[model samples]
Target chain A: MGVRGIEIKKKTTMENQLHIPTVAELMAKGESPEILFWVGCAGSFDERAQRITRDICKILAHVGLRYAILGTEENCTGDPAKRAGNEFLFQMQAMMNIEILNGYEIKKIVTACPHCFNTLKNEYPSLGGNYEVIHHTQLIQSLIDEGKLRPDDGHIFKGKKITYHDPCYLGRANDVYDAPREILESLDVQLTELKRCRSNGLCCGAGGAQMFKEPEKGNKDVNIERIEDVIESNAEIVAAACPFCMTMLRDGVKVKEKEQEIQVLDIAEITARANGL
Target chain B: MVSQFIFLGILTIALVLFGRNAKKIYNNIKLGKPTNRTDRKSERLKQMLLVAFGQKKMFKRPFPAILHALVYVGFCIINIEMLEIVIDGLFGTHRAFAFLGSFYSFLIYSFEWLALGVLLSCAVFLIRRNLGHIYRFQGRELTKWPKTDANLILIAEILLMSAFLTMNAADYKLQQIGAEHYIQAGAFPVSQYLTALLTDTQASLIFVERFCWWFHIIGVLAFLNYLPLSKHLHIMLAFPNTYFSNLEPKGKFKNIDSVTAEVKAMLDPSLPPPSGEVARFGVKDVQDLTWKNLLDAYTCTECGRCTAACPANITGKLLSPRKIMMDTRDRLEEVGNNRDKAGNIQDDGKSLIDNYITREEIWACTSCNACVEQCPVNIDPLQIIMGLRQYAVMEESQAPASINAMFSNMENNGAPWKYAQADRANWANPE
Candidate 1:
């Protein structure tokens, strides 16, 4: 039936796990889950994101933090598809992810993608899945707090007037605007702000799957507008918290032919560098 | 005496009865969920000073909007004159607040002129709606509610306008005979002209003025009681609602679980837990909705502004953001009726997509947040749509088959498009 005829009522494909006694289960599970990592679309699909997440996993192992992957490997949280008019695909993807983390006795989940963090942590409970979802910026911030990662502050990218592009997902969608800024501060990169930063950050032409489909009529692709704002501000470097925003803004920089004048970096990559990785 | 009593009786019945029902339903829906911080009183007071009094949204459209602000100011200041008409009828003393007689009289003329101009501007609005050929694709939302009963509103508008002119002519005659003229010779000269019409008969002018004043005041009261049921409801709902508009950007989807979990914890202390059987998530239906949704539903003026902005509607998609609001209003009426009668709303539940709005329409929403931004009154259709989607997906398990499949694939393969679980970190390779 190609998923069309499969009734959720009959076979119970997507379970409304909302009514389950989870706090009691958590009491049995221990103080915290073994792992809490955000699995983003890029973490699942993009080669660079996969590498970054795998690197993160290796770092966690090296640091000896108790954690488990929500999936043994990784999965897309269906945010991309849902944002597009393809609700069917988004729901299909979301319902398919039966994250048997409960069976594995896992609680906390840390994620690399802001998109996944938003979708899993924000949008998922409607489909009856709830978990304590944390992003890498937050996890890294906690790690820094625990005195695990210390910056040498001699990075080559230092002393540049760098402006940060708050990704719509991370900044506006999740309100995680400050952690990335704190990480950027740790690197000693000169921080600049755009007029439309944080909650008012413009969408990169990627969200709602506009990255896949064409950007419809607007003054410009929201990302291009943002990148131009950065260029107009004359900042030398632009860093972002989300990979999707990084890729989209980087593409925008390329399209504008200002790549020589500007650089785009992710929070994790910057954090990894600051720690002298 | 009886007519005055009857006129007021109608207003009293409408406000005390119908308005009470609206208020009751409003309060009940408000009681559906606790409102956290939607209406910040200080924020509203600040917006009243900065935006509403400053005429900010009007400033966006410029000239016509300036004229609109004049009418708005006129509406505010001259409401006292309406009270005078009622008081004079019920107790016979007029000019209740005539301390600066010339200035107050000038205000009367100015407010009257502004009312005339407001109607002219409303005519422009009617023309834009009818002939502008805008809002084409928002399909039914743009076309349906706005289309129906617009002519009646227009006709009543014209009638009220003509009444204003006629009433002014009669009152000018009265003021000419009874008191000082209310206008400059260069500006109006109507009172000067009224001398020729009134041919030294004070008694006749008094009767004419009394008749016009009565009709004018009665017409206004009729308009007021009618306001709650008409497109003009925006007149009242717009100002208050705009002042209470959501301060956050329309595109920002705040985490719903954190808030709902707090609510659930407060509501039921010994509740078992969140698992797979229920949603600690977005609203699944109107019944599942919070108070703001109901307010947003009631607040819709069916102006089709959101429909006009909807890209999907522009692309000939069946969805109209404005129509969803109109339908919400329509549904609220039905639901309220059913609830009042204590009838169980049948769960042979007609699929919302099929019966209320189209599935294609529901799917067509891009969530671009334009509708929310452009809705001068600050209605958020995106969250409402998400809530409805939540209900269908969570409780009903009724969704587009493709989404179900995507969920399956996500469960098994860890991607919307099924991909190898091992391949998840495949992208993290060195470029």
Candidate 2:
């Protein structure tokens, strides 16, 4: 049978699904799957994201948690589908995933992508998929609290002012504003903020499947508006918690040709740096 | 003598037409669910009542909104005056309203001047429509019309308002010269100036008043009768549209389940939903739509403001949101008129999107909140379009090709991006 019509219809089949991304899916997954780190979409597909996931995986192993990567075997959690108004497809995809996660007996999921984090923690339960979802920044903060992640003073590149960009999914979508900043503060107190933050942070031009389709008709993309805010601060390094934000910000830096002038790093990578593997 | 009867006939016709339309509106509203914003009982009632009469959003955009308010209120009070004039003509004694003496007289004078302002502005509007760019969107040519609808309505207003002015001037003249002393004498400033001009012939002020009153009354009736058939039909439709507008401020859209009785029958014959082979997903086209939707298209005033705010339209996309509404109206009228002739609407085997609204217009919306928000009259072009999209995607299996792959992948892989569903919560895992 052709599965095209099944997309939005699957939503009706699976009633009681809130159709929102859940935050509960960010915790650790698997009993003995060697590595169980949530390779959220940004980390699962992109080489750079995989590298960051691998780096965080490597860093966390030293901190005493066994982790495995979810790579090509990864299934989308339907965030983009819902955002794109492909609700039928979103529900179906979410169901297939709930089965997969249930088979894995996943208890928790940690994601670098807040879209994945928000979907997993906040939305997955509506589809009967339940898992504690946490962001890598939260993990890093937890690791620090547990004394497993200790950053040396030298991990700090002194005299360099840095600002953190809050991804909409992380900040506005899940209210994970403080965790990323706290991780950054453990590294640098220069914690300057862009004018718009938290609930009102500008979208990185990648949310709601805008990454797949064309951008809306506007003089500039939403991400460019966000990066302009970043560049205006003139901070040496612009740190973010979401891979989508990193890509958009970096794209902006390239479009404006401010690449050599600015550095965009995930908060986990920056925090991992202080741990000095 | 005949002028008085003519005025009576005109008033009777206007009342009948307006009464029929008003009954239809009231019945539709009765059939309609309470679609207003989510609030407690009193709050919703207040909002609806206020929105209908308060002109809350009109004030958001200054000059046009204020000018519209003048027309709206002027149109309202003038209805009373029109009927009253007809009454006076058929039966004689013209009674002074609460405004005959002091405060109301000032209001009458000022409102008359303001109505003049609306008339002049409407003239500018007519010129603008004639000279404005020919924006072509969704196959409906929203134009600086060869016969502009807004301008025609404005012209009707000008006719009605001019009649009012002439009648008012004539009333002041007659009453000043003929009425028993103080009241008419005081209110008739314009007539006092005309006293010198009328010295020669006793021009019989009562006859003058009746004639002027007939002009005012019949002129208004002519405008009213022209309203439904004209573009200005939106004036009547806009209030109820606002009243029934979706008040859902929630960011989350309703993601309904797709398993209807038909699909259930197709699957496990036992536990099917009661309806057989029902549309489980969403709307397919015009007839599959809710009646409120039908009303929405019919009510559009073709103001290109929706076009202006539409991200798709602004970005050079083929979607003119206003045209979507217009197309719906045209299609509804076409289908409705033909529904009886064809015996069965589907017998003709014509799809609304193909024969009515185009596929290009369907694909253009980014679902941005602009059109819904910017509509001064509370038209939700996005939802109506989404309803059509529902039909195209779910019922017809006619979604855009780009989203086709995405939808396919989601069905097989459980995610738009085709990631492992099991890995969804993989991020919550620690190293």
Candidate 3:
């Protein structure tokens, strides 16, 4: 169980528990999935982020969407390398990934991480890797819009005050502001906005390779400042879309000693919980 | 005849000096590496029109936007009156464009209104900068010269607008008295209030009118010459800056073609080795930056909007995007001066990185694009920061140990962690 007492449902108990297929498995079956679910490095490894990954999988299963994961073949999108100024390593990684993606004939991708989403959608095109890429929030919003998924009216999150933190790569970097909020609205939660939301949204201090190391000297940590906004919004729950933001904000809530009061959950997690998946 | 000669001489000298300064700036920008911003011609023009001509981005901060728009529009429209001033100065003609009759009156009437707008707007700006305690105006980068430069331009605008109105008032009095060569061809709506300040006598009125005319013309010329020296260069540079804006998703940093070729050769053994003098990986100095980056440096308004919005600066980090642009421009100016003195760029032992901008500032950026988003002229400071980082990592291999650790992790394990690639799918059926 996570800090918020949101039980991490085991694989055996998940409803309609269809086995997720990797791209290689689908390819071996002489078929192609409709979209590729790019579970980024954090989603695969980070404890907190892995829970969101499971919820996303549950949503895809509930909706019966034909999605395939890159699995062992997926590489880091080299976002941190490119941003940290290691263009050589970034290009090398980009070339290898582009080769594999092209080989797989992948058309569209949905990622839970904005860093991977941003790189694959925006930066990869110039490196001979182009595909229709979308964040998981966009995919979730569309699923709700298409009437394929619905939040249970009497779900636990009903009327709960939740604020969405805009991931820099998702919001300002790509301008996908409304999709997450629209998803929240459908979940029947009170969507309170931070003072700095949308294009003016503050970073969770985990961007631009900053997550890999200690931040440069400053008066206070950037995440602490962002947590102040979350506190100021007075929302009981903070909804985030990016794995990096999840880690940073979760750490911030603990630092502020508000873990007992405020629960930091990804939009995917909230949606999954609201739908009783 | 003597006054006409003197006027021509002053105009010639001012134009010549301004021309030289413009050439120097052009050459300094030319020193930068070139990137293609010329592809999207129509889109560029449209952007220039909307962002620069239309003042669209300025309106993001409504209060200052309204005030800035007043000064901008007022000053621009008033410059139309400069045609008459220039013609009047040349060939020693009085009211040279006065032959248009009532239309001239309408033009003068509108100019008077705009002049008054400019005068008041500049006064308000001065107070806001000095007394309003606006956070955007105060920063470590704004100490001394930048501060004085801003106040000087505001004060100059106020003086120029006052001179314009005073000149009009004295001219109106001359017209009322029906003095020689005073044709009474223009309207005196706003300046009509100032007419009482001048004596009714023709001798005194003529002296006052002539004094103001000379002051207005001389002041305009001096200001023109001063544009190259102050942050006021944005008044002219913003147009081109907005035009050459990166017209792509803000997150899409340009891929280094040199690195691409090297990577291609490495991946494909069949390909021949890349043959060329290796270029520097990223921007270490002004010359290593793209010409568009250099132009962005020149186009900075020093408004501090970028810094005000920066997450790093907000968190009290050393990074300030405005300071990055300012430092770039300052180093460029130093380089330009060196080239002028030596007839070529002499090694100054100082570079943009580690000298003007420190590693602390560069490392503090999260590349959030808040700075880039807040820039009214579409200046991209994050590009320069990345460029500096590129130099540090590729050309110098000086990236922080943690970043290097992440890099090696990605290189070996295919992720930025120590976990094995074979275990990547373990999340699917976690224990």
Candidate 4:
């Protein structure tokens, strides 16, 4: 049988379907989840990003890992406020979130957004909210390492050309460069790296709360400049880990009229599609 | 005896001037707010050694790194020769360390090679700055004074190295003819070749030898005093700046403690009220910054690597990280000078934010940490930009319209968008 057929046969043996449970719903049943999924504001509200969010949920369910989303209870992590220099607003949001997280006695958290991941992991501690935080890509890499999720079983992306755009917050800010690349590497795709990758990765122009505002007067939008790197990579599929990058890259591709030629997919979505979930 | 007195007098004047400049810089840095960079003793030391001493980060650009390493090593090794010159100048002796015999000769031989390296590297640097089309050196902020300042330092180094080599060559010629007090003490490798350029006559060689010797020493002293006023201060500040660099993750900006305290009080009414006088929200002037930020300004060599890597600046935005550091240093110097002249800091109807760094430049930053990552000495120009932004947002409430809308949405809707909190999890079951 083909790899896809074999994967389907193996999947049929497992009875658990893709069901996303809220932290509140799980708590009502007196059942605590193994992990709390922090769907950031972008992943929660952004249309393109919500697909990636659902894919992440699908992956968690496929792996049979008990993970619950904060759902309506989760608030913005105040990354934009902090970056925009609204320290008062940032601290207020941080205190509220810290209270909620500590009240739940939460120990582990995972998020798909680099901004949220960076803030929760790095900025939350000083405000008395400390959790064992991991990015969704990091979680995926670990799942692959544990042999729970097998990318080799899915041959959909066996030889497709893909490029991974390292989000500034994930790569340079937190030094989490390897996990996403490793997950991509496992997919058997022709991974082309941009000239600026890893610590030298260029920004998509949506960081520092710039996503919420129009860019200052410049010759070209920062996303368009970043798109030049994507075009130079000559990859058909551009893999992104951050929702902010997904939006910016999507816009850039559309502006360049290459949306028909290039596809911007988050790493979670790619992994879930590869698994035929 | 007359020459010795002149030498002593010049040395005393240079030392006194340099000491005063150092004190002024110290007090200016002290004008900044206090910060705790003293933690992580061993890590800081290691960082200083790796970055400043080893020039580790400079290797990111290999060609410039090589040239800079030559100049850096030459600058440091040549300073050892300065010790011998200082002793000879003070004691009216020739090659005072010549007592070490062959070891002194070995040191002089090494210094000659380094001097040659420095001379050539500086010449290349001058060409690269003025002639070569290096984008980093051609920023809008580098016009006029900044440009002249860089070229001037390079020319000075070239002149200083030439004077050193010519002194060695003339001394070699003097020793060959057995001129008085021109005792044969050290070996000359690079300078020995230059002996052909000197006149063979004894009196002329002596004149050339003495003239070059005096010029080299005076030039060295002048360079020492010039450091405080020039970007060359990086030579000294890079060490301490790297030592006191932010050790946390680049994404982890410092939380405003005053804001944190106020927020904590608001969240819990049972908690005691926040004490002390009301503090300003963000940096409006030099004094609002941390001592480390001030040190970063002084430590900046204006290489523009930060600007070159900046996505905003790369895409033609006004936000150049190098300019931020330059403006900070410039504004700090203005404040320091004002205090020096007026007996205390008198407001000159100017602040660092509006007077120097523009709101346009501050808002253009993407906060990507590329500048922070690209900085060789770990200067966090982003911190300064963020501080200025804080002042604009909280103190003045003059954020751009779009950003103001974002703030209101974040405050009211619990998100940057206008979506309701109730629908936040709608993505979980998105069709």
Tell me the TM-score of model 4.
0.96
State the lDDT of candidate 3 residue by residue for A117-231, as single tens digits.
Answer: 9999988998899899999999999999999998877877878899999999999998899999999998788899999999889999999999998998878999999999999
Tens digits of per-residue lDDT for model 4 on A1-277? 2433644554444324556898788889999889999999988998878778877888898888888988888888898998998988988888888888887788999999999999999999988998999999999999989988886473677888999999999999999999988888888899889999999999999999899888888899999999989998899889999999999999999999997678888999788867767
lDDT of 3 by residue, B1-431 (tens): 89988999999999999999999999999999989999889999999999999988888899889889989988888888888888988978887878999898899999999889888988999999999989889888898999999999999999999999998999898888888988878998999999987788999888888998998999999999999998889999999999999898888888888888989999999999799899888989999998999999999979999999998998888899999999999999999999999999999899999999998899899999999988999999999999999999998999899999999999999999889999998888645
Writing each residue's lDDT as its tens digit, candidate 2 over B45-161 gives: 665566657767556457667667777777776566555455566764454454456766675666566557667777766665567554422224554551566656777777766
Which lDDT value does model 2 have at B342?
59
Give, for candidate 3 chain A, the lowest lDDT window spanning 10 residues.
A1-10
Evaluated on chain B only, candidate 4 has a TM-score of: 0.98
Candidate 1 structure quality by residue, lDDT tens digits, A1-277:
2111322232232122111122224446664546755556666576555545654654565467755444433457668655533344455454445345444444567887777777777666665566787888888888887888777656655776888887666765556778878877766778888866664455565555445444433344555666888998788778777777777788889989997888776677666555544
Candidate 4, residues B258-338, lDDT tens digits: the string is 888888888889989899899899999999999999999999999999999999998898989999999999999999999
Model 4, residue pairs in steric clash: none
Provide the lowest-lDDT 10-residue window in model 4 chain B. B422-431
Model 3 TM-score on a 0 to 1 scale: 0.97
Q: Write the residue-wise lDDT of candidate 1 on B1-431 in tens digits.
A: 67667656755764576576557556545534555645577887776566556666545447646656765675666576676666656654455445566776676667566666766766776676577766432254545546655656666655665555555565565555555432321123333344465434656665666666666776676666666566566666665666666665344454445434443444456964445544334453455566666667777766565766565655455667877777666665666666657755544464334567555556556565656755656677776676666555654676566666656665567665567777654433323
DockQ, each predicted model:
0.11, 0.12, 0.83, 0.80
Q: Write the per-residue lDDT of candidate 2 for residues A1-277, one digit (tens) a residue.
A: 2112332343233323212122233243314443356666667556556546655765656666655544434677777766555556656556656767776677777777877777777667766778877888888888777877777776554446788887766664456678887777776547777765654355566654556666534455656667888889888788888787788888988888887778787777676555654
Best by lDDT: 3
Model 2 RMSD in Å is 10.3
Q: State each model's TM-score restricted to chain B.
A: 0.79, 0.80, 0.98, 0.98
Q: Candidates sorted by DockQ, descending order?
A: 3, 4, 2, 1
| Residue ranges of candidate 1 with Cα displaced over 4 Å | A1-39, A47-277, B1-68, B99-103, B136-138, B143-145, B148-151, B154-158, B177-208, B239-285, B341-353, B413-417, B426-431
- TM-score, first chain, each model: 0.79, 0.84, 0.96, 0.93
